[model samples]
Target: MTLKRIPYDKPVLFFGNIRDLFLQKVTLHEFMKSYYMRYNNSNHSICGLYVGRLPVYQVMDFNLTKDICNRDFDHFMDRVPLGMQSTDILADLLLLSPGPIWKPTRAMVSPAFSSGKLKAMDVVIQSCGEKMSQHLLKRENPDKEIEMKQLFGIFTLDVLTNCIFGIDSNPWKELNSELIAAFYDCENYSILTHLKMNAAYWFFPENLRRFLKVSVLADDSVYFAANIIRNAREYRLTNNQRRNDFLQLLIDNAAKEEVKKPENRLMDEKHILSQSILFILAGFKTTATLLKFVSYELAVNPEIQNTLRAEIKSVLEKHNNVLNYDTIQEMPYLEMVLLETLRKHPPIPRFDRCCIKDYKVRGIDLVIEKGTMVYFSIIGFHHDPRYFPNPEKFNPLRFQENRNPHGFFVFGSGPRNCIGQKFALIVAKYAMVYILKDFGFFSTNKTQVPVLGKNGNLDILIHPKM
Candidate 1:
């Protein structure tokens, strides 16, 4: 089949003019959406462009996204291999594994985020939230303007440390928490860095990049994290500690253990470390980022924030001033606000997949040759006017029922969707509910409300209601 010529503002290079636009501090996904809208007049979803010598497709259409992600999973079993250049410990993580190993690894790791498991972990998350509450309370001025991102980062790091490592990385007890510092270091990614991070996948491919000795992480932060997980695993196994957390679950069938039965050995200490790193990525910065964005959206939109507060207060009253798993599910408005926040600003701006087989386009006669890389613009789909009314506006009501799963790819969709989705959401809710219950938010004099600015300060003063 023949492909339609993608309208270009400039000739194709590694980025063509998209790089220039992106350097203007706009996200690549936003730039692509703006470019596509301005250039295209057709209803078609798929378009082709060249990134360096590679032929890349930017797919924003939900139908096309569904097909690539779910309907025809066999055709695109592996992700586009971004940030998997090293043969280091991260390669064993589910994120970089191709189809063959991904299935089994996913199955082993999936149970860690089960409903019962997250419920048990919620008590830990709530305790972390309580520590965060005390932290905020201890501020010299309770109503002082603060950078919410850092606060949320501490909160999420606390939760992830407890859930993933079964150890408290509590900044309250340890002033110089390297774990917290390492979590911040892992967040060294931005729109500017995304280009370099993804370039290897665009040209070298993952295997060749590994062959060329390319590494994804810059400093020793990953190694530091792995060491922590290793110690935690050793301590847990030695003491026979039975914490209902991720490390404990993985240790049950650890890869290092010698299992005579083939069905027994699905993971090992390396897998645990890899997934611990993954948890640090997914549960730490990304979750904290979500909280900040949700707060920012609420700060800019007062009515919506008040409405959410009403729901939170009502839910707390129903639970007799307690925040627990069952009560969290009662706050539909809270759920809506978070969902709308995700739709407005998905945690990861975009997702990609590498076509593993020569797959024929369902409607067209052309075949996407094996190894061709494709990117799905989460920003494009979230902002599409057809799917989201007043797409720029923050309307929580839009997600009350959440029937439009395919149309909204926040946690992603299909077999390759985020495994820790439920865990992340539950933890985030625990933090948000705790914060919103005691405090009221308003704009600080210096705060500039950001829609999705990567570097925007977004400081807001939080005051406890009298």
Candidate 2:
């Protein structure tokens, strides 16, 4: 057995070069390119890296990612959501739990997302999408420049609140509400806050993190988010009423009594709260981002947008002007456009796993030590030329053409990929279809044509959809 030292790329920081990427303030794709080029090894030479003194093994090769995330699932089974072990609800989240905690939790929670369950919720999602369209229409002033993300953000908030709380009211319609205030208070969207948060997540000492009990989310936000779940569950238990929504699923599956065993992790109230909050956090931002990018792409590519509108019209006619899960699924071009959007602008830029056992890198003689964190580069691969021809160019045809499906890592690859991917796609497509069916998104004077913003962020403008 030989332990060969992995190649290193000199980082320009006291801690390590990892934070340098954040400091440069580049898009996720650009940051990956900078390192991938600087390292400049077709082989896995630069796969192991130091981000601010943190040793992280980044898998750049597609096959290697498949090996680590899929073929060797048992060896690399944990995702570092917060920290591996914490008394906080972060530890109990379906996304964060690994191995002993993750396996059972996944099974218990899987039923909530079955095909039948999702179909039941689409009715509400459709209504929310309609509400979103109406909201846009009410504010349809061409002179007044509107940022699409804000509108999409409100839309996502409405949809998620309806699904999670089973309440038809628009949470965003009235910003003065205590819960809304709590959400905003918890989230500090300033660039500086983001940099600091990234640094803390990447470089701050674990002991200090635990000692200070530092959390990226604010306590008020957590309290408010948890309270929503509490009130809903209490009401459900008191009344014995069941609704066709995720909240109902959580209540039904959640343990009525306090949980005594590790296997029954989903039974506890804290667990319910964590899952509920995660649903809101996860569903809101990413889906909103997707809508923004998709709209921007459609606006820029008017021809494609027109084609899509026609297709949406045709599909609605086929369904007799009814919007549902089945109708959204029927539109292939819409699906293609969204898929391309994901490929070009992936919400989540990276995938990670914790090495549970000593595993040998296939095709290469390297042993990834246990307890090591491995990252699969979603951004790098998405922009890779080998997989996608003219990777920078926006082309939905790539999906229609016969290209390697493995190249696209938007939702990610293998068993641990996004559980809510189908549902997310369904909701995104529904909103997109409805928006395009009635309105046309073209470049406005305030429009930032590029998908990536000036500062490596998503900042686009819209003057009414038509």
Candidate 3:
């Protein structure tokens, strides 16, 4: 047997970019940015690299990147498989499932996040935000520095548990919450955990990894979440209970006839369970990270913060001092702040897709072969001075003029973009409005500045140097 390889003339990293990532020399995001700066040229739109023996193509040109993600989406419909489908329940997640499974599942889950559904879910989010603001207002030491990440984590968990599982979990009161413990455990961000994941990606063969049960999620966490979902589903069915939650939507929409049809697979119990878990996993950490970044920005940029607060107040006053879906959408400056925060500190800084069919470059002599991995650096485009001038400076005004730029991929682009984006925005916006209504974030001596972020399974872990 002979080895197969794509002919490449542009910059190539022979040993692949994984070496620096494994050595902690640079993060996944940083490596991509560095590669773009070093090898990106007007001649070629793509670069060549390897993850161990597997060949990978890094897209550098913005037009070509747009084509891959949007125009030529059918040729690259699915993401690079994680090779854990047989052993891990998480493999079935909408974020991980193959195109066959992803298409119908995405269609089924999409309605659950519709404008009407989000409007109904606004009450639940408002309740959670109210509780969080109340807790902050009651803080014994007003001058004491608050850990915004932890606070936002609690707020997001509370909202997700209530909306996704229909569990009224007051995370603020239950600091030692069992559900919280399971969530963090399932999405572990420790260096060792990431190392294990990289080992699986770079070294272990797919068959061997499955034989050894090299799972991405923790066993205990999976079991805990499974039990909770099963119990909630069973109780609702038995009692004929209906609630305004994602779980309820799934149950109601579950197919009753021709259930064995391939197209109806999303209605299966297993798929529904998988999607429920995914909603929590996707919504929890990312939304919290957005809140943390926004808070940090507001603390450091007091003038922008004040302008945002004024917008929030004006919107609320017009809407009878109510924080709901309609009122949230009315606050344009608040949206600008969130947009700038996402640009600077995107929770997921990079995205990948796998070529399903051989795709020839329109004007070049390159053909992306089937099963080849394609990578795009969102942070690179986000921070590019060409797209965002003075990218390092937090300027909400930049967004005020151009709300959606071609380079902006915070929620991603094209058909496979994030489905829960509107849901996440509503939750974050409500929390910001509720908190800023009474409290203002200000920097103190204890305040820490974010220098870099350590990549996690589902999001980036923002780390500050002491």
Q: How do the predictions measure up, each by TM-score?
A: 0.91, 0.89, 0.90
| Model 3 lDDT per residue over 31-125, tens place | 76776555544456676666765677877677888899889999999988876543445657888778898897788789889999888887888
Whole-model alpha-carbon lDDT for candidate 3: 0.77
How many angstroms is residue 78 displaced in model 3 relative to the true structure, after the best TM-score fit? 0.9
Measured by TM-score, the strongest candidate is 1
In model 3, state the lDDT of residue 339: 88
Better model by TM-score: candidate 1 vs candidate 2? 1
Q: In candidate 1, what are the lDDT values of residues 325-428, reduced to their tens digit?
A: 98898988887788888888776877788889988777755578888888776777787777887988888889866635546887777799888878878877
Sort the predicted structures by lDDT, highest score first. 3, 1, 2
After superposition, which runs of candidate 2 have C-alpha atoms over 4 Å from their true positions? 1-5, 22-24, 27-29, 37-41, 81-87, 140-143, 175-212, 256-266, 401-404, 454-466
Clashes in each model (backbone N, CA, C under 3 Å)?
5, 4, 0
List lDDT for all candidates, in order. Answer: 0.74, 0.71, 0.77
In TM-score terms, candidate 3 sits at: 0.90
Candidate with top lDDT is 3
Ten consecutive residues with minimal summed lDDT in candidate 3?
457-466
Worst ten-residue run, lDDT, model 1? 1-10
